[model samples]
Target: MICRSCNQEHNNNFCPNCGEKRDVEKITLTSMMSYAFASVTNMDKGFLLNLKMLLLKPQRITSEYLNGKRKGILNPISFLILSVTLYLVVLELFKIPKKPSDISKLPSGTLETLGNMSYKAGQFIRTYLKFFWILAIIPLGLAQKLIFRKYNFTEHLAISSFIIGQATLVGIISYLILRWPLIFDPVIYIMITWMVYRVFRTNNKLDSLLLAFVVLFLFILQLILITFLIGLSQV
Candidate 1:
């Protein structure tokens, strides 16, 4: 049979050159719906597999992905995006009110200016929270690079993405428990620390302790940077 994808001759169910299916059926509504449903099912399976591997064997999953065993598992960036999107949807579905930080200590003039500016400027920032998330990934990657000097930057990035995705899921659960804006921050930090330690398991207790401290330091640094950005925007 002639392969349509690469114009190469093949006699299999799929094109060996490009892996496109050879069973070219007529276009119909039923076919389209079936194809869409199949795609969704495959994606759902991939995501579930990724989640299970991340929870059960994070190091193995990262190593496998870095080593080019890529098929049948969700990619890190896609996973992160999906997780955050789902989290945002959950927040909206529950009508979770935004809990602003306490600014009572600031001067009345500053408060007034902030209240005025925040409504306009804050909307832009809130709408692009994903950008802030990507920005934080850089520093988080750097922290991982410092701790695991042998790994390349891209490897650190992939792992960090997966970690952030998992942390988002954990944050949703944490929110349900306390329903406080900042309450999930500590939980996320702990989740990150545990995830990283699982990925880079060490024998020495001191190494584990240091990783715990490093995760806390990174979380604190992220918090400070975000606070500074928000404060600057208020000005």
Candidate 2:
């Protein structure tokens, strides 16, 4: 018999080439539901397993993930997506008001004019949050390459992505608990420092601390520049 799908010879009850059952002509809704549920269960298991590994042994998880052992673990991109989604959901639920607008409504030569610092800071944070994942990858990838010295660039990116994802999750949770000022100030700073220390444990402890400080300083400087531009535009 010839398999209609692949135009190949078949001897079984189904098409050997395409593996389509000869008796089954159409997909049923039942089959679709079954597949959908199965997929959801598998994905949930994978994400939970990855989350456990990330919390328990982050360094080992990163190394193993980069080494191609990703069958039961969450992929870096998926991890980031899940985390950021939850973060935004929480932010909306709380109805947290964002920072003030850049341009003040005060008339010229007003003695009680408000400085643009607060509005500029808000703009800076908003921009950073939008592309935070991409920006985070730079320091993270550089850290992996510089510290490990053996992993390939792709592997470093993978590790960096995972580390950043975990840190992002932490930041989101902190924001939900403490609101904006705390989120932008001590909370993020402490979390980034802790993440750096956790990822580079094999290196000298002091060096990891120093690197974390450097990274935080650079991030703050970038924020300042973004805010300044936003403020100037409003003027």
Candidate 3:
């Protein structure tokens, strides 16, 4: 097969030269509909391909990337970008909470800052969620580094990014179905546990569970700390 992106000849599922998936369907009405559906549903071929690999064979995907097989699907950062984009869109479209609880308890400085701003603290968080997300991943990467000492921090970061991105997607779907934000917590835990377990390929279930919960706890703590700091800035 000829690679679509690089025009190189290859006989495998992916082009050796450019890493483009082989045997891409020629455009037709059906193909167009499929594309439209995938786009609307956030399940495009690339995304679905990545998700399938991650879920069915997490270790394989992680190892493949670490071993220099970086093609044929979305990379971790790209996956995260898409997830965060969807989150921002959903947050904007829906009238969710814009004020964190205990706003009244904020110091005078923080209150003053909030008063001067056109947007609330929650609005700020929602608007620049991607930034917070990246921030949250730093500690997570560190935690994974401690647990999976075999991999470097950056490699652990790639794994963390994919896990968080996939978990966010699941959280969004859970919220849409249950119409309750809290319900998404379990969904996140479930997704993270499975993904981490598979990626690490650990034999001890306790290790995976502990790592997942620790990461979750640290992420939540970071968010709370950030929220507190944002409020304190007003004072």
Clash count, one per candidate: 0, 0, 4
Write candidate 1's Cα lDDT for 1-235 as tens digits: 8888799898899998999899888899999999766644563356667778888888888888889998777888888887777777776776666668554555678676666555544554567766666555666777888777858988888888988888777877876776644223578778888888887777886787688578658756865666556756756
lDDT of each: 0.74, 0.64, 0.70
Error at 221, model 1, angstroms: 0.7
Give the poorly placed runs of model 1, Cα more than 4 Å off: 25-45, 98-105, 108-125, 182-184
- Over 1-235, each residue of candidate 2 has an lDDT whose tens digit, in order, gives 7777787787889887788666654679999998656644563456556666777778777777777766677787777666666666666688676556536564445322336544555556555554654455665566557655767777767766676667666777677677754236467567666765676665588876776666556655655555566566654
lDDT of 1 at 203: 88
Candidate scoring better on TM-score of 1 and 2: 1
Clashes of 3: 4
Locate the minimum summed-lDDT window of 10 residues in model 2: 106-115
Candidate achieving higher lDDT, 1 or 2: 1
- As for TM-score, the candidate ahead, 2 or 3, is 3
TM-score of 1: 0.80
Candidate number of the best lDDT: 1
Comparing 1 and 3 by TM-score, which wins? 1
**Model 3, stretches more than 4 Å misplaced?**
1-45, 97-123, 180-186
